[model samples]
Target chain A: MKAALRNPVDFSQFPDANGHFDRYGGRFVAETLMEALHELNEAWRDCRNDPEFLAELDADLAHYVGRPSPLYYAERWSRQLGGARIYLKREDLNHTGAHKINNTVGQALLAKRMGKTRLIAETGAGQHGVASATVAARLGMECVVYMGAEDIQRQALNVYRMRLLGATVQPVTSGSRTLKDALNEALRDWVANVDNTFYMIGTVAGPHPYPLMVREFQAVIGREAREQMLSEYNVLPDALVACVGGGSNAIGLFHPFLNDSEVAIYGVEAAGSGIDTGRHAATLCAGQPGVLHGNRTYLLNDEHGQITETHSVSAGLDYPGVGPEHAWLKDIGRAQYVAITDDEALQGFHDLTRAEGIIPALESSHALAYVTKLAPTMRPDQSIVVNLSGRGDKDIYTVAALEGIQL
Target chain B: MNRITHRFQELRRAGRKVLIPYITAGDPHPELTVPMLHALVAAGADIIELGVPFSDPMADGPVIQKACERALAQGMTPRRVLELVREFRQIDAQTPLVLMGYLNPIERMGHAAFVAAARDAGVDGVLTVDLPPEEAAEPIELMSAAGIAPIFLVAPTSSVERIRRTAQLAQGYLYYVSLKGVTGSAALNVAEVAEKLATIRACTDLPLGVGFGIKDPPTAAAVARIADAVVVGSALVAKMHELADDPERMRREVAAQLAAMRQAMDQAGMPTAFAG
Candidate 1:
């Protein structure tokens, strides 16, 4: 893979004109709630510069969510995949068992700072719901989560965890009874309660400030990995890889390294069956440009502009669209988007579990699947850092059922 | 004849149920779209609703979404769909054709350009999903100038004031969304739709068409009893998907479904002369 196109925009300028990421992101929300989003953006901009805010977040991450998770060298997996040396950033070991808590905690603290009393969120695989609930309890705020009716059934245990954490989980039955429906319901709720409530969006998706904010909180992953690789290998990795479902984890691991001209950023999408089968969630690799969830991004929509169904082995990555930032990154050649089929992801899953003793979430398995392709071509001295976004505990049952291996 | 007004008056005078079959213009295959329109008319379609595939249809269900996907995968475009309509006009000039879709494609094509192109293509009306009657004044004026009826939707959740406003702005038949959810959702309350239709009747004299849940012949026939027209979408779209590999089979099955609805509605009353 070649080097990524340099991102011309500087982070120091913060919230570029029209709130865009090089003409990709902006406030494309409903008119009734523009003031609310604007207020949020202003508050976030102030907080980013405040040392007190950053210090509080750093303390919470250290004592509450357990930051500085280990960087594991997957020696066995590297040999098996015949790839360049593979290193895993252990975000999956973070509190709440996924990278979602990283953003949720940061946003919850911001919500408290903004004097908001209630917090609301939308979840797809229930990971974000659990993370939000966990943080709301810690912050002593009222939390409400909207989930698709279908996801509620599929992830019943996480739904129970959310309830146990003193959060209200509302099931959305609109649209396809999936993530998009939950998002629509959450948006309706946000519009209705914009004055008193804070919407803690789970991923680097949504209208504007959200994608940028979530990415900022997640940038820690890349910063730590870059520093660790420099100390351990005495050189920059040839490539950075992460799974892209709404692109939170990917953006987290990609942003800090955007200025690194020598590093290649690869966003691996979940191709449930295959791209040709029309059942995959590889939006940028196979889809066209369209507006979805208030963002002008690439979506798997039909000619009539109706959103199509998407499938993936990982419930978390099964959405039909990717984040708008990812779309823009691909357009500018800042990143290369590829897809890993369900079978290949499964192979990656089993290989990681057996070789590295790390049972990765199906979502993270997408990145592992990409390494299997990129490793054999690289020189032995080259390095690839994979953001292990989440653990496999929540996905064990799903993977077992697919493999006909009863737990 | 002013086909739209004449058709509405004819259905009014006869007290017969109108059969409006919706088909995406380039669905399954673009080359087969015009022939499918002719086949549908031959199988007893009174009005043809040609869906112009846009990139986003917020109100449609999964079945119609898939149909749009197949058409788009085959490289179907709005211009290609209009070309199909122009070809359909060559054989059946009198049957009313309505281009149903969202505002973006029309906006992207430019409202003035769309009206001009549609008028030239022999289109009689349009039903843009997102364009409320409140925001429809300018586009309605543009369409009306081209002699194209600007059809509008009246939902059951709509307040009486909104319904009255919608009725006043709507040109052809009023489209009454049969349920509270998007297109293809289950749980249709025909009684609720009928009551809403009656409320709308107090505001305007236009014919009302009930859609969004008319899936089968029985449901279509039931809706036809109270409303002037029944719009069947998901059932027909599902048929297209089931037969996407075979265009001839898709056309036959779709035409058969429309013919079944037509036959069921025909039993309610007989055709009468055009009152206009």
Candidate 2:
């Protein structure tokens, strides 16, 4: 049976006045950073609408980042599913080999306009670190990235890549020694250097301006995909699928099509073992709403409000909190969120590699895993677009090691 | 009168500066926490700031962060820390005790409920690390109604407008983060702090308590000479961290450091809260 597609609906104005998407996503930082957030919000509000800023961003997106990343029809994978036709939005072709650069370029430009000379960011998989470093190098600014020591050991290739781009990767050995701890270090750095440094938050999380600002910057993915679908098949995708870590790529792809009631959206989270067994990053699915890293969102925390350690095979998806806007979306029934276990996502990696001859980042495999379940249930005429967020070259070693082969 | 106001008002009448010391409620060892509070008072502390262990303490540096980790390892909760505070109040009733921590635990307990529990726990005040004045209206009002002074931090990076707002909302002494870095990082600069305090002084008549990077007696004395109070945490917590195996030695060593800093402040002609 096919799902009904409703007609187009008007986009609702959210995050009103105070940057809140409903009851979530407000500014909950220290007093010292209140001034800085205000400054960034004002600068972003002015630049987001300005012709000069948008032109520079557009020019850079076209010439520098190689924008309009092709929407490739995964013909072989579609045949293997024997159901809905699947198309891949190739965000992996972007500079830095991931969708992260889309927002970094815009934020680096904003940092320049704000007159900040330094950039700081936190990374778990080092994808965002590489993107941040690339933009910082392009802008000729000093860049420092905080990564958990445990992550630095796993993502050694990206650590080296970030350093090659003239950026410093600081290892955070505190707490769980992962993305959450790295974010704590980054927040501490921002509080101390609030005068001159700009914190380039990688995901659509953090305080007020960051969620809204990063979403707007990365929204180009969905905007381009929407037009390309019309230009190619003359129809909107029946369903859109993307992985949600801190949910930057997912939100980017989902934001533009939010008002299209006909388009069904799904966000896949990395459930390391599984949600019922605990130790998963499926905040929206299993976790409760709480405050972490300056925003009220669904978080994986213990009974005493202590943020619990999260586990995921994909370093990029190993966060305890999801983006606040996703929380609002979940509550308002605009999109659906699901969790895919490590074994399922690993199967996704293998299937995509063999079928489409395209290796996806482990983070992207979660989305692919969901599509396997989703695609088989739909008709051949129905189509689905999956945001292939990044390439899997970084995960080759991890895959080999998991098979007991030393690379 | 409330303990914080009474302590400050008594200091003003006596023409003396205030000296406060900070220690994590469960650091080194959970059982030793209330004992250390008593020892700090015995070492001439006019007020105390008890740190509530949080999972992610963004404002703290390495030492204090490690301290929180050790505290959490011993299974410290807001309710347990309140029990410890209640036990400490059994022996000492005069020295003002302020609970300092992040906003999550209190948010979990709800604004009205947490404020009421804190007042019942013999807590004199509360300073939530991440709750700025702009977002602190409800908590401030609840604390005020509960008779628990709502404290706030004013950093050197704060604008005059922010300082004014913080001072207006803050009921107890204003915590002046003497340096731009976290609690345990950076070196203290007296001249820069003095300059910033001049701007803060113009904004409010609230007693200013200087903290961050004040590790030694001389630095504590220097800040005491210029500001109304000196609050030291990381250095003292580091000492407790070093003597983790021996709670008595950690207590004695930490108390000794506080005593020496207090003597240095007095030797520099800064009167104690009880002296003129």
Candidate with best lDDT: 2
lDDT of 1 by residue, B72-100 (tens): 77877777888898998998988999989
Candidate 1 lDDT score at position A70: 74
Collision count of model 1: 6
Sliding window of 10 residues with minimal summed lDDT for model 2 chain A: A1-10
Summed over model 2, clashes come to 0
Residue B198, candidate 1: C-alpha displacement in angstroms? 33
Worst 10 residues of 1 chain A by lDDT: A1-10
In DockQ, how does model 2 score against the reference complex? Answer: 0.68
DockQ values of all predictions: 0.06, 0.68
What is candidate 2's lDDT per residue for B184-276, written digit by digit as tens? 877789999999999999999999999989989998878877898999999999999899899888889899999999988776644465345
Q: What's the chain B TM-score of candidate 1?
A: 0.94
